[model samples]
Target: MCSVEGAKKLAAYQAVDNHIKSGYKIGIGSGSTVVYAVDRLAQRVENENINIICVPTSFQSRQLILKNNLTLSDLEVASQLDICIDGADEVDCNLNLIKGGGGCLLQEKIVASCSKELIVIADYTKNSSLLGQQYKKGIPIEVSPLAYVPIKKRLEQLYKGEAVLRMAVNKAGPVVTDNGNFVLDWKNFDQSLDWNKVNLDLIQWPGVIETGLFINMAKKAYFGMQDGSVKVQS
Candidate 1:
């Protein structure tokens, strides 16, 4: 039987091999699971001869690209990307995602949006019967570093949900993002959600750049199961 790690590795490798095209600029995503995908792509680097510009979602991802010997480029220079393969914390049947668990959601979403196609590679645990079933930390909303107390209250009143300031579990104060922002993890949904309305409502909020709830973003998804099975959803 294949180990869980081995299964994840196989799934990522297959996803990369099947999707990546020659001469296409790709967006390399962050997180532990995506590391496997990068590794697999790296192994074929010599043979592909592709002029791929890898846009990283975080410092860790930048290093992964460098370590894998993949070409890296800034988003300013590389405005258009061919594909973006990333990992998600949770993905519903409709392909709505809950990411940013690793705090790279801001950059990840930006890269994904810029790319021609966004493909998500995750373990089966990330797949949910419905939205928010597997991962329930609430959608991670990154806000400006300014006063977020009022923003939190406004989110509760306007959106009818709980917005809690994300604490720096590793440090002393609030968790600061790569863009020097703060993360507000919203919760307390008493009923089924209208994700479309929620997305529109949150985007209009002041000081909010990107929310963790990624709706209608993914073009394809690969879920690696424990039994060495890979499920593709598109």
Candidate 2:
């Protein structure tokens, strides 16, 4: 494996071994990094016989659970989760994260809210002192398809950044989220602004579903370093 891929695997495996326990309900997150996390979870179930019910945060996550032959539950059955292990686009020093680079932000945040603790697993390149310092994909904003234009214009006017519809490379139109909502990548925003307040404000707006900004949510983060050591930040 390449260095980055190796790092991601290391972090995911470590996070699973450290946080997951027998008879606990876990929230599975989306994206490439999470793929490794699921692999580790499946291994633990098979080798150690550690039984756990997995609650998926996205369609991709649900598929992963099924493909791994791990027991799967929905929010209705498992409203409260023991812990959530997810990946981030960027993780700041304060543990703030910019997620949803893969259009799974809405469900990811919902599942996180239901979990007791959130553990972010990532590669070293995703760690930064600020949200936009390393990751440049921008804050993903899941919005109503009908009001995307107004929300885009309003966000640009207030935040002084570009909000573009995320397009699908393989598909013909914009990238539709699992919730069937369109995503607006609000890039180049003022990094100095209070993200906590910004997140609250954004959620209250009409046609706004959820933002990629995960402020004051994570309990801790584990970053797989280039040298193959895992770095833990809380």
On lDDT, the candidate that comes out on top is: 2
Candidate 2 C-alpha lDDT tens digits along 1-234 = 339999999999999999999999999999889999999999999999999999999989999999999999999999999999999999998999999999999899999999999999999999999889888888999999998999999999988889999999999999998899999998888888899988999899999999999999999899899888999998
lDDT of each residue in 148-181, candidate 1, tens digit only: 7778888888767688888987799999889899
C-alpha lDDT (0 to 100) for residue 62 of candidate 2? 96
- Each model's lDDT comes to 0.84, 0.94
Off by over 4 Å in 2: none
**CA RMSD, predictions in order:** 1.7, 1.2
Which RMSD does model 2 reach against the true structure? 1.2
Candidate No. with top TM-score: 2
The positional error of residue 31 in candidate 1, measured at the CA in angstroms, is 0.5
List candidate 1 stretches off by more than 4 Å.
1-4, 47-51
